[model samples]
Target: MLLFDLDNTLFPFRQYWEEANRTTFTSSPLTNGLSYDAFLPLLKMFDEELWPLHVKEAITLNELRVERFIRTMHALGRSVNKEQSQHYFEAFMENLLSSITMDEELRDFLDKLQQSYTLAILTNGKEKEQWRKIIQLNLTSVIPFEHIFISEDIGYDKPDPRAFQHVLKTLNVEARSATYIGDSWTHDIQGSIGVGMNAIWITPRQASSINENLHLSRTIYDIEPCLFHLNRTTTIT
Candidate 1:
C-alpha cells in the first residue's frame, strides 16, 4: 500500500486557492468593491504574516483562517465583525471546493499504481473539507474513501507518530512494508521515518530538508520523478 499527501503533493493547491480567492473576494459583499488584482497582494501579505504565528501555536486554526481576513479588512480601513469574517471564510471554502482539479500526469500514475497496490491518502485537514477534495479530484475512484485518513477525523495530526501508526494498523501493513510521500519536511518525512516507513520528500526548491548532507532521504523535485522511481521498483501484489 502507498500513503500520499493530498495538498501540494497530488495537486498544485496554491493555484486552486488563488483562483478561489479571486472569485470569492470579488463576489463577496463584505469586501465592498475590491478587484482581485488589488485585493490579492493584501491577502497574500496577511497570510504570510499569519503563518508564522500559526506555526508557533499562538492562535487556533479557526482563528488563523478568520483573523487574516479580518486583519486584511482592517488594514484596508474597513472593520469587519467576526461573524461576517467567518461568513467570508466559509464562502472562500465553497469556492476552493469547487476549484479542485487533479493533475493529469499524477492521476495517470496513480491509476497505474492502483493496479498493483492499495493506494491511500494520509493527509491532515478537516474531514468534510478533505472529503470535498477527494470527491473533486476523483481520488476516491482510484482509492476507496475508507482508506483515506484525515487528521480531524483521526484526532491526530502528522509529525505525531500516532497518526502514522493509525494508518499502518488500519491498512494492516508493517511500517517497513509501506511507503509515504508528501511535501512537508516535518509532518510527512520525519513523521513517516520515525515510524520506519520509507518517505519521499517532494519540494519545488529541491533543497535539503533535514541536513546539508541527508544520508538516506529520497528527495524529488516533483511527483513525476517520484512516479518514475516507483514504477521501476514497485513490488507487484
Candidate 2:
C-alpha cells in the first residue's frame, strides 16, 4: 500500500497558501488599499480571538484561512456582515483553487507507484478544501478517486490512529505492507508509524528534525529522485 499526504507533500502548500491568501486579501474591498504590513495587525488580532473556536473544531487550515480573514476585518473595527463574510470566504476559496500546482514529476511517480502498490491519499483537513486541492491539482487522474481519505469525512485527523486504521481497513492491507509519504514529522511520519505503517519523511524544505522514535524508513529532498531510486531498487532486488 502506498499512501500520500496532500498538502505540502504532493503539492507545495506554503507557496500556494500564501499566494492565495494575498490574492484574497488584496482583492477584497475590506482592505481598502491598506498595505499588508498595516493590515497584519488586524489579522493577528483576529487570529488571537478566533483561533480558539477553530481548535474546538480541529481547525483545518482552509477554515482557519477564512476565519482569519473574517476576524481580521472585525478586529479592524469593520463590520463583516454575514453576507460579506460569506462572499469573501467563497472568493478566497476560489483563489486558493486557482493557486494549486502539483510538484514536478509527481504525476509520473504516482503512475509508476500505482502499478506496484495500492495508492491512496491520507490527509488532514476540511473535506471540501482537501478534495478541492485534490481535484485542482489533477490528482484524481493519477490516483483512484475512491482511495482518497479526508479527516473531515472520517471524524478524525492525522496523528490519530483511527485515521490510519480507516485507510488500512479500506485497502484491506496490513500495516506492515503499507508505506506512507508526507512532509510533516508529527502528523504523517509519527502518525503512520504509530499505527505500524512504514513512514517516509519528504523533507523538501528541511523544516523538521529527525526523531529517533518515529522509525522513518527514508527521507527524500524531492519526490522524483526518490521514486527513481525506489524503481531501481525494486528492479535490482
* Top candidate, metric lDDT: 1
Global local distance difference test of model 1: 0.77
| Full-model lDDT for every candidate | 0.77, 0.72
Error of 1 at 151 (Å): 0.5
**Who wins the TM-score comparison?**
1
RMSD in order of candidates: 3.9, 4.4
- Candidate 2, superposed: residue stretches over 4 Å from native: 40-53, 58-67, 74-77, 101-104, 204-237
Query: After superposition, which runs of candidate 1 have C-alpha atoms over 4 Å from their true positions?
Result: 35-38, 52-58, 101-105, 206-237
Residue 39, model 1: Cα distance from true site in angstroms: 3.5
Q: Candidate 1's residue-wise lDDT over 1-237, tens digit each? A: 678888877777778898888888778888767666767788788889998787677987788888888888887878998899999999999998987776566677788878867788899988899888888787877888789999999988898999999998988888766778787989998998899776677765643334211212333234444444544554312
- Candidate 2 lDDT over 1-237, as tens digits, reads 778898877777867766776887788887776677756677767777776677577775556666777677765667666567668878867898877766547777778767767789989888888888888777888788889999989988888999999999987888866777887888898888899776668764443324322223333334444434444433211
